[model samples]
Target: MKIKTTEQYNRIIQGATAILLTEGLAAFSTTKVAKHIQMAQSNIYVYFKNKDDLLVSVFRYHQKKYIQFLVDRIDLSLPPTDALRNLVSTLDEFHRTNKESLDVIWSIRQSTTLRQLIPKVSDDQIFIAIFQWLKDWQHQGTVRQLPLMYLTNLVFSAIIDYFQLIDSKEMSPNELAIEEIVPPLSALLFV
Candidate 1:
């Protein structure tokens, strides 16, 4: 087995994450990651048990970054409208930055087993901030009083559907159509 220096280990993991983000998890392999990092395949084995373990680590790393983005963007003290707008902007930025990985994430969601493997914003502490903001909005009568879980899942599903529509090349709807529909759909559930 080739033992990697600490820096080399981090480099390998970073390279592995790039592969997953660009090629999707299905195409991500330890050998490819090692090659990207200019390290031996055995060096990766020194840091990870196997490809599955490495993929999970990479998924967790990106998920945590996304959670941080949301946390930094949302101000619980702000009015509901402002908070929601900020949240949307944060998500738009995330989707824009990881467009390829986001598409891959959608593909992974098709596999129920894989969905379990991917970490979620809800599972992170930052999402608790969102929950608190929602509760505050409900108390102020600015938003609906539905259970947070119900609303969360509802919004999540709607957003996923919107992305799917965009991903479906054959459907060929204009971008304006999605932009027009998504806000109202989210607003209906939110308020």
Candidate 2:
């Protein structure tokens, strides 16, 4: 099939993500993306220089979607505690609806090659905003004095672990209610 429309670019990224999540990076290739989307392999080169470029694009595509979701659903201006609760609820909502996105993120995170190829996310605008928000919380004595990155990583790491447990069948979302989960998460976030 001919990759004539701009929509093909989106298909390429989606196809690549599906491949990475299902078959792992070892099975990822621009040709595979093309084949997955029923386009010619050469057509993929029209948008990406190589597999690395395509992989990075795929990562950024999903990451931007996630960041946008947070920006839209999480009200950063709320009192810090309320903001954190909204953030947790937003994450749970994301986990329920976009589990494949979490899988794609985890797959890229575990890959050394992808990690090196993907640009740093710390400089992303929403990321900086979150970091600054953490700093403000610290200033207000809303959270501990630990380094911002440490606190951020701790929360994100725990979220990832929670998702992984669900993915691995060690935990079931229906078995535990969101109300059952919120208090402990709040305890962790607040001083």
Winning candidate number (lDDT): 2
lDDT at 182, model 2: 57
TM-scores, each model vs. reference: 0.73, 0.88
Model 2 agreement with the true structure over 6-58: per-residue lDDT tens digits: 78888888899988887888887777777878988888888888998888888
Runs in model 1 deviating more than 4 A are 1-6, 21-23, 100-111, 114-121, 164-174, 177-186
Q: What is the lDDT of residue 102 in candidate 2?
A: 68
lDDT of 1 at 134: 71
Compared with the true structure, all predictions reach lDDT values of: 0.66, 0.78
